[model samples]
Target: MSSLSMDKIVELQAWKLKELLKWREYLGVLVEAVKEVFNDRVEVYVFGSAVNGRLTVSSDIDIAIVLSEVPKSGLERARLVDKIWSVMENKGVPWWYPFEIHLLRREELSLLREAKFTRLL
Candidate 1:
């Protein structure tokens, strides 16, 4: 069996706290970018490990962008992604940020209800 000393446990916790703080700041910038790009047309939510407090150094920020009207085709979705990326890039958000964006309609929001999430916009 293996055990961690109390000091080691505290050290690990402090590291996690620092990581969480970075993610929170990143999320704040993300929310602002979404607002600038989509205005009132979409609602954003943070889900998965980020919202559930299972955050780790390797965890990706999972976000769901609830749209008033979801794109109906693959090409449309791709264009939506491009538009968002363009706006985010213009706002100084890195294109390679460790995050995933899920585009959904209001009706589809029910599918994610089983997951822990908090509205960001």
Candidate 2:
């Protein structure tokens, strides 16, 4: 059996949600930075545990960047991801806050919906 009781689990989950809510402002800043670079060609979404009410202690917030066109080269994609990471870091996102940035084309939005994702920006 688990060490945590049902009430304890509920409390922990609520705490996780509260912790995630605190980071939404930083996420807004990130969205603006990406928008500055991509203009209207970008849309940002927050999916996975953060949006699905299944956040675990180890869950990393998942961010999806939906664009008109995803970079074709892996190197370009890596650079873009790195730049976004830098923006988050500069905006005071702590290293301990686990998160992921994914690049996708407009066509992939349907897939995100199928996977039960939510848009943040």
* Every candidate's CA RMSD: 5.3, 4.6
Best by lDDT: 1
Query: Against the true structure, what is each candidate's TM-score?
Result: 0.73, 0.74
**Cand. 2 TM to true fold:** 0.74
Cα lDDT tens digits, model 1, 44-87, are 89899978888776677888999898778989887876777777
How many backbone overlaps does candidate 2 show?
0
> Which model scores highest in TM-score?
2
- Worst lDDT run of 10 residues, candidate 2, spans 16-25
Superpose all Cα atoms of candidate 2 onto the true structure and report the RMSD in Å to 1 decimal. Answer: 4.6
Error of 1 at 23 (Å): 2.0
- Prediction-by-prediction clash tally: 0, 0
User: Model 2, range 1-121, lDDT digits (tens) per residue?
Assistant: 4656877888987887667666566777778668766766578888887677776666777888998888899999999887877777777876556678889998877777756676767
